[model samples]
Target: MLDILIKQVKVLDGTGNPGFIADVGVVKGKIQEVGFITRKAKLVIDGNGLCVSPGFIDPHAHDEGCPFFDEAVLNKLSQGVTTDISGNCGQSLAPVSERYWKENQSVHALINPPECMHEFTSFGKFLDAVEKKKIGVNMGFLVGHAALRIAVMGLENREPSLAELEQMKVYLRESLEQGALGLSAGLLYPPGSIAKQDEFVELCKVIKEKNAIFTIHIRDEGDYVIESVKEAIEIAKRSGAFVNISHHKAIGKKNWGKVNTTLKMIEEANQDGLNVGFDQYPYNANCTYLNTILPPSYLVREREQLVMNLRESQFRERVKEDILACREKWDNFVVNVGFAGMLVIKADKTPDAVGKTVSEYANALQKDPFDTALDLLVDNHLDVIAVYFSMSDDDVETVMKNPYGMVGTDGIYMKNKEKTHPRVSASFPRVLGRYVREKKVLQLEEAIRKMTSLPAQRLHLKNKGLIKEDFDADLVVFNANTIMDNADFIVDSYAPNTGIRYVIVAGEVALKDNLYTHAASGQVIRRKEF
Candidate 1:
C-alpha cells in the first residue's frame, strides 16, 4: 500500500524524454512506483490525461521576506513550482543582525516579508529556523557576499582589510559547510560593486575549497555589459568554481542583440573547463528600488552625507545631469515610486496603485518623470521602485532557446496586488503556455527538463528534481492545451496561470484542483558537506 497514488497520468519524468501514460505511487514523501502501479493508498487522484512532471524550480529569485511570507507563493505553485532558489542578487534575510535589518530597511522592504526569520547567526542556524518554521517550497540559498561585507564593513564599498577578509572567509566556509549551495555577488549593486577583483577572488577561493558554486549579477547592465560578464568569467577561471550568470540580460535599446556575443563568451568559458550557465526572465523591463539608478558617487559617502547631498545644490545638479542621460539614452527607465507611483500587486497598499504607470501619476501631479522619481525617493528615503520597459521579444525568445539558459521570474509571489509584472505570476506558465504551447519555441519535454532536472543538477540536490522511485514526490499536474498565463504587464498583473491542476511538495498537495491550501510543508535544502 502507498500513501497516495495517481491513476492514468501522462508522465514527463523531468528527463526531457518522451511522455508515457503511467500511474505513480508515493509513500513517506518519496516516489514508491511509476509505470504500472498495483497499489493501495490512503488518497488516490484520478489524473487521466493530465501531465505529471517533476516540480518546477525557479533558479533566481529574492522573495525572502516580502510583504507577507507566503504572499505570492500561490502564483508560483499554480505554475507548478515546487522549489525556488531565492536569497539571490547578493541578499538574504538570515545570517543578518537585528542592527543590519534596521539600518538596511530601505532595500530590504521590497523583498522581505513580515514573517522573515532573523534569529540565525550562521547559515546552519538559518536552515534550522526554516525547518522549524516549515517554509513553503524546497528552499536553497546563496550566501550573499554583500551581506557578509556589510556585516563586517558597514556598507563601505571598498576592499576589506586583511583581517576583515579572513573573517568573511570564515563565515563563507561556515555557510558552505552548513548547506548553502554557493556564493552570489551582485556586482552592479553597492557594497558588491565596490569589491575589487582581488577582494572577490579571495572569497571565491574559499567557495571553491568548500565544493560549492559561485553566481553573479554582473557589474554593469548597459554599454559595458560585455566587460562586466568578462569580469565574472575571470573570477570563475581564477577561482576554479562552478559559476552561474544571474539574470543575464542587456538592458536598454543600445544593449539589444549583444546576447549572441555574450553566449559566445559563455561557450568559450565552457570549453576552458569552467561549468557556466545563466538564468533569464522573459520580459524586457527591470525593477528595483529607486536608489539603485542614482549616480554611483551619491551612495559612496556616509548615510548622513547621502541625505545632505540630496539637499545640496551640487548634488542636485549632478542628479539632473544623470537624469537627462537616463531619459535620453534609457528613456524606458520609468519611475515606480512609492505605493502610488506604480501598481501595488504584491504590497498591502491601496488597490489604485497596482496597475497604474508612474507616468500616469506624474501626469496627474504635473511633474517630470525624473522629478517625480526624485520626490518619491526623498519621501520614502529611496526605499523601493519597480520599472518596466520594452524588451525585444526576439531577444527573450533567443535566450530561452539557448541550451545553457533557464527561467526565473525576478518577481515575487505577492497575491493582493493590482499592478505587477506578469512574470511574478506568469513566468513559468508563460514559458509552457505561451512560448512552448503557443509560440513553439521549444518542445514540451525540453521545456519541462529546463525547469526541473537542469536546475536540480545545478543545485546538486541529492533526492530532489526527479520523479523516479525513492525520489521525493515533488510533482505537478497540468493540461498542456488549456495552460495560459493570465498576468500581463499593463493589465491583469495578478491573474493566475490557467492549467496547473495540482502541485505536490514532499508528497503533500500544496495546490489542489488549481487552488492553494497554504500548506507550509517545505524545508530548507542545503548542500552536501563533504
Candidate 2:
C-alpha cells in the first residue's frame, strides 16, 4: 500500500519529455511508483484530466528573512512553486550582530527578521535554523557577499587589505563547507558594488573549491551594461566558478533592445567552457527604489554625504548633470503610479502614498521628480519601494526562450489584494498560463523544464525537479488550459490563480483545492560539499 496515490493523471515528468497517462504512488515522503499503480493508499486523488509535474523551483526570490505580513504565499503554491532560492543581490536576514539588527530597525520590524540574523555566522548554521523552524517553502541560499563584507568591514567604502580579503575567503569557505549553494554578490549595491574584480575573484575561489556556483547582480545594467556583463564573465573565467546572473536585464530605453546581444555573449561563453545560467521575471518593467538610476559616484560617499549632496546649493547643478546623462541615454523616464502601470506598493508604514506616481506626488507638492524621489527616500528613511516601468513585451518573450534561463519572483509572496506589480503574485502563473498557453512562446513541457528541472540543475539540488520514482514527493497538479493568473496591477489585484488544485511539499499537501493549510513542511536546501 502507498501513503498517497493519484490516479488517471497526465504526467509531465519534468525531464523535457512527452507527457503520458500514469498513476503515481507515494510512500515515506518519496515517489514510489510512476506507471500503472495497483495499490491501495491512505488517501487517493482523482487526477483525471489534470497535469502533474515536478514542483516548480524559483531560482531567485526575496522571501528569506521574514514572512510577509500578508499570508499570500498560497498565491505561489497555487501556481505550483515548491522551492525558492533567496538571499539574492547580497541581501537577506542573516549574519548580523544584535547591534546591527537593532540599528537596522526597519528591516527587522517589518521583515520580522529572524533570529538567524544574530545567531549564525556560517551558512551551515543558517540552514540548521531554517530546518528547525520548518519555514514555508524549501529554500536554498547564497551567502551574501555584502553581508560578509559588513560582518568583517563595516558599511564603509574603503578597499580591503590583504588580511581583510583573506578573512572574507575564510568566511566564504566556512559557509560553503556548511552548505551554501553558492556565493552571491550585488556589485550594483554599496560595499559589494565598490569591490574590484580581484576582490570578487578571491571570494569566488571559495565557491569554486566547493564546486558551488557564483551568482551576481551585475555592477551596471544601464549605459555601462555590456561592460558590466563582461566583467562578470571575466570573473567566472578567472575563478573557474559557475555563474548565474540574477534578473538579467538592460534597464533603460537606450539599452532596451540589447537582450539578443547579451544572450549571444552568454551563449559564446557557454561554448568557451563556462557553466553559465541566468534567471528573470517575465515582465518588461523592474521594481526598485527610484534612486537606482544614479551612477556609482552618487553612492560612493556615506549616507550623510549623500544627504549633504542633496541639500547643498551646488548639488542641484550636479544632480542636473546626472539627470541629463540619464535623459540623453533613455528617451522617457515614466514615473509610474498605481493605474499608470508603475505602481507603488509595499511601503508598509505609510499607505497613503501607495498609489501615487513620482510625477503626481511632485506636481501636488510643486517639486521636480528627482527632488521628490530624494525627499521620499528621506521620509521613508531608505525603505524599499516597487517600481514598474515599461519594458518591451517582445524583450520579455525573447529572453524567456533562452536555453540557459529560468524564472524567479524578485519580490516576496504578497496577498493584500491591492495595486502592485504582477510579478509578486503572478510570475509563474503568467508564464504557464498567459505566455505558454495564450501566446505559445514555449510548449507546456519546455516551460515546466525552465521553471523546474533547469533551476534544479543550476543550483545542484539533489533528487528534485523530476517526477522520477524514489525522488522526494514535491509536486503540483493543475489544469494547464484552465490555469490563469488573476493578479494584476489594478485595484484588488491579488486574487490567486485558477485551475491549480493541489501543491505538495515533501509528500505533505500544503495547498488543497487552492487553499493553503499554513503547513510549514519546507527544509533548508544546502549544497553537499565533498
RMSD of each: 3.5, 3.2
lDDT (10s digit) by residue, model 2, range 1-530: 88889999999998888899999898987999999988899989999989999898987876665343433344456668888787788765556544444333222233345543567655666677676664666777777787677767666678899998897788778777777777888787666667889999888887778888888888867666688778888998999989888888776666777878888889999999987788989778777654444555565566666765666658757765766655322212331122244355655555555767766666777777666666665566556365666566787888889988998877654434445566766788888888899999988999899988898888889989999989989999899989888876556456677888888888888888778777777777878855
lDDT of 1 by residue, 1-530 (tens): 78889999999998889999999999888998998888788989898878999999988877666324453256567678888787787776556656564434443455653544446567787677656654557777888887677766667656789998998888788888888888888776677767888777889998778777788888766666788778888888888877788878776566778787888899899987888898888776666655655755455566566666677657777887775465322222332122233432322232333345555657777877556555555555554456546356777888889878878877754434535567877788888988998999999998988888888888787777778999999999899888888877665776777888888999888888677777776767888865
The whole-model lDDT of each prediction reads 0.73, 0.73
In model 2, the runs with Cα more than 4 Å from the true position are 67-75, 97-112, 308-313, 326-342, 347-350, 413-420
Reference-based TM-score of each model: 0.90, 0.91
lDDT of 2 at 32: 92
At residue 68, candidate 1 shows an lDDT of: 41
lDDT comparing candidate 2 with the true structure: 0.73
